[model samples]
Target: MSDYIVEFNNVTKEYVRQVALQNISLKLPRGKLIGLVGPNGSGKSTILKLIAGLVRPSRGSVRVNGRQANRMLASEISYLSELDVLYPFYTVAETIDFNAGLFRNFDMAKAREMMSFMQLDPGKKVKDLSKGNRGRLKIILSLARQVPLILMDEPLSGLDPLVRDSIIQSLISYLDLEQQTVIMTTHEVTEVEPILDTVVAIQNGQLRGMAEVEEIRMTHGQSLVEWMKHNLA
Candidate 1:
């Protein structure tokens, strides 16, 4: 079995007028908190979509746990999209119940704990949620699933400072690094750099750099964001 949790081999993806990813290859090991960092339109989100089996690579292959990513792979991966895909009419409690009914791996205990950590109210309807609350709910739902891989596209986007802090803390609190790996995308690199084990930077749909967070700090004498600023300059 491959030791890597995620592997992309010579992958390229394109739309009609643009290429979102280009001849990219990456192998990420398990038991890590990886930060997918890049500017807008950098295809950071595309990587997560590929891993989640939501989009096909135009060329080559994407794999999770040595198996080709597909609909069945969804069973092993818990994906939290950048967009809020929950039913707006459903109360948070009902939404959690619905997901639990869908995935046997969904853990009600974990969901309730994370909800309390994020200060989410189970009785509140999704439609009444503020942007920050919606983001929190999305994360809570994903984290509740006991899966080997968790792919989050901009998990911190649209959140206020307080909620962001709470979410980060909850991630550290809830994740069992021995059993699972998390890959999250965000432009707010400075805020996330402290917890990241690795950082992958992409630009213009191509990989620019990737490395361990400490290697970056030791070699460049800067945080991931500062190194990105220097390199992206």
Candidate 2:
């Protein structure tokens, strides 16, 4: 078995006239909570999409579990997009049931447990749920999956501090780090600093640096935010 769960080797991605990602290479270890932080349009989302195999790379390769990334690799990953794609007409319970039917790895028991933990109303339609509740539901859907990798794009975006705190707490409470690896992109640096095992900094479509969260504090006498500022500058 490979030590890394995901690897991007000299990869580049372009869209029409814009370069989304430059020559980039990365190796993400298994069973880690990795934070990807960068300015807006810094190729963070593109990196996640490439890992999910939602788009083909323009150069080099992306690999998951030592195999080249492709659409078929979707089975090994659960992606939480920044955009909300839930069915507004479906009640909370129905949405869970639908996903349970769709994904072979969907853990129905885990979904139910998370639902109760998030205090979501089973009978409430998705449209009626507040944005915070909706966000919670989205998280439950992603985390309940039994896939080895989970990619979250701006999962904390637009959420109030309280909601973000709950979500972060839920992440710590539910994740079996021995069995799953998570890569999350967020602008909430300080909020997520406590739970992150590693932090990767990206800028202008290029990887700036990657470091262990504890290493930053212990060795450099700096927080992730300080490290990110120095690297991204």
Candidate 3:
């Protein structure tokens, strides 16, 4: 009986005329780095939103740390989305301070350290920073939270190869597998393959596979990306 930090039980989400998710059920064990891979509009973001309590499921439930996903557990979970939603008027430091003040579990020191490592200018206003810097800032703020689970969606998108490498390195150094769980959704499967403990594949709003990374490689004799390409085809 492994302890689960996050659990989705037959969760479903629908938008007016379309079904975004269809009876999705999954359990995320504690302290594992899980990766979610799927094509666009496969309801990947919707699943993250449901877990973050940004949106409620149309049917079924999502639980975090043994409680219904809600604002009460905001301190226990940190979510970094694909979109950077910083206050345009605030400086990078100000944004971090705001998050720290809002979330009791936020670590200001960790945020500052991540900023320094990423070569981000804390004094620069959000509007003045480039897109890449904004993405890095979002990651720093999210990862710095002293939370049980961290959810990141498309963290590696919209960046050059060099910057992507730097982001990956920062994520690896910051992760503490003994205490924290990380769930990241990305199309850059190969980039994350080496670091992911488990991989969950989604297609057409349905779970295709969920298994340990090494077991997948052993059974398929191909990298996660290659396996995904064939299965997702």
lDDT of 3: 0.88
Judge candidate 3 at residue 175 and give its lDDT: 83
The per-model lDDT (C-alpha) reads: 0.90, 0.95, 0.88
Question: TM-score for all predictions?
Answer: 0.97, 0.99, 0.95
lDDT at position 52, candidate 3: 90
Model 3, which residues run further than 4 Å from truth? none
Candidate 2's displacement at residue 150, Å, is 0.5
**Residue 164 displacement (Å), model 2:** 0.6
Lowest summed lDDT across 10 adjacent residues in model 2 is found at 68-77
Model 1 quality (TM-score): 0.97
How badly does each model clash, as a count of residue pairs? 0, 0, 0
The residue pairs found clashing in candidate 3 are none
Deviation in Å, model 1, residue 137 alpha carbon: 1.0
Candidate order by TM-score, decreasing, is 2, 1, 3
Whose lDDT is higher: candidate 1's or candidate 2's?
A: 2
Task: Give lDDT tens digits, candidate 1, residues 72-100.
Answer: 89989999988779899999999989999
Report how far off residue 222 is in candidate 2 (Å): 0.2
Winner of 2 and 3 under lDDT: 2
